[model samples]
Target: MINYLYQEQNWKTQLSDLITDPKELLQQLELSTDQLLSGAILASEQFKLRVPRAFVAKMNVGDALDPLLLQVLPHHLELEDHPEFVTDPLGEKEANQLPGVLHKYQSRFLLTLTGACAVHCRYCFRRHFPYQENLPKNNDWDNIRDYIEQNPQINEIILSGGDPLTLTNAKLELWIKRLESVPQVKFLRIHTRVPIVTPSRIDDEFITLLKNCRLQCIVVVHSNHAKELDPYTIDQLKNLTKHQITVLNQAVFLKGVNDCAEILADLSYRLFEANVMPYYLHVLDKVKGAQHFDLDSAQINQIYTELLAKLPGYLVPKLVREIAGEKNKTPLYGETF
Candidate 1:
């Protein structure tokens, strides 16, 4: 097990001190650099390896195949060019209306607050996103507010990014208060991986901020494996639920990570234990540098079939795929490939 010294540090300290070097990550896990180091170096140069130490501690030492490790560890396979895998997998650029604004679904308006994240998952669809150019400016809030006011149908605002929770509480509060000013925005949703990777980000002050918000708040966290939900992570998630903030989990079906029925079921049970509802079980987006994680239709069908048999309706997450230009997330049932 990794040292608990990181537990003493604040979330900001943990965020600033991510393990960026592939060699260092391998050494930390006690894995040899002979076979893995070179490829990792090449792949990381393209996308970069960023993972918090606290999250790294959850990995099985010396076992390079650990699910959590596979998610973040850069590999040579990522360097291979797959014709099917393009950078803009979801076609989010077309939906991007203003700086930091993505108007995909009709009622829900998404905002990419900042381009920073605590852990850089290898399969992230937004890895190739042009965050620097699209990030909203301070003055841009006026335009954002005007846009929301113009569209009275938009009742929800989703705060996404690299991860919205990665921002300081003050920054988050600034955005939240601005969203609250808009009478049309009845719900505030945050799509983040912070609570799972760095639970300390869900600090008391952040919780208080959420509690004080007039709009109903929802936090959709990403956690593919049951191993990701340690005691502290579970407690942090529960803290959100305890404060009347709706907490949900969305997991991607990644090969060598969470492809099996049994593993996905375990994750659902663990999420339920934390009072978090199992949300979407996403099929991997065919983004560049992530073809290695994709599974065939037959493989996906079998695993999801077994998963349906294993869990009750409430515990089973909706198996969905986001197709570019589609009105909604296309639900994959039975043999619908």
Candidate 2:
């Protein structure tokens, strides 16, 4: 497990420690000379895999090789030309009923709190999410609070964005207090990649805030592969479990990422072990630039059947798709008994 109190090494220091020789770093993730020379100089430090100080402690210190760290490190040169990715792929702005409030579903509202993330995932469904135009400033949160106050039918408020946990503890506390004022909003869900990408975000204060909230809190984390859940992440997951937060995970099926039966099974098993329920294994949303990541329903069904054979009913995450304008995610191919 990762030690929360451990000192954090700066990204530069961390990279210096890893790169014994520049060529050695390139060999690990399998980059070509053309790939490295093009813009590798531009983001060389970023190329080295970086996990949070908390995440690093979870790994075997004796063993320098770590998988979770690699995923977050900015090695992919493809990110440079990803400008076509846009800010809002799903057109969430159109769905926003209020400045910071998005009523994409009937009973639930999504609040765009902050536009920052510790690490950017390449396969993010909202890679193009419009944060500049849509994000709520500290004072602007009143707009969201007022909207929810008026819409008593909204029982759930989803805290989203690049990642809501990126908000400071105090700011988050204020937001929760405001939301609690609305008696109708019974549930609060936080969709985040922070705990997975940077486990340091999980701490006593963070857990305490969630535990003390008047509304029932549920955390839906994003973890694509089993490798992403290291010892530090597991400890963080356990903290959420102890708090009685309904901890769940939703993974987007990515092609070069995790699109296999064994990897999917391991991801589910790891989540279960860490006390996070495996909720949904989502088929990639067909956004413009993410076309390479899409997996067809036929292949998804094959993996689903294989997963069923490997794990019990509860352990298997639903094979699902989220269609725009749909009330809920539709299950694509889970067999009925």
Overall lDDT per candidate, in order of appearance: 0.93, 0.69
lDDT of 1 by residue, 1-337 (tens): 2435655679898999999999999999999867699999999999999999999989989898999999999999999999999999999999999999999988997899999999899999999999999999999999999999898889999999979998999999999999998888999999999988888888899999999999999999999999999988898899999989999999999999999999999999999999999999999999999999999989999999999999999999999999999989999977657
Clashes of each: 0, 4
Poorest stretch of ten by lDDT in candidate 1? 1-10
In model 2, what lDDT does residue 180 have? Answer: 91
What is the model-wide C-alpha lDDT for candidate 1?
A: 0.93
Per-prediction TM-score: 0.98, 0.80
lDDT (10s digit) by residue, model 2, range 1-337: 1353432433323322333233444454354465444443444443223234444444343232244433333444434445444445566667877667779787898887877665555455665666678767678766776777787778999998867887778889988898898888999999987777666577778899999999999999988878778776788789888878999999887765676788888998999889999998888765544555656677777877888899889988888777667778778885431
- Candidate 2: deviation at residue 264, Å? 0.8
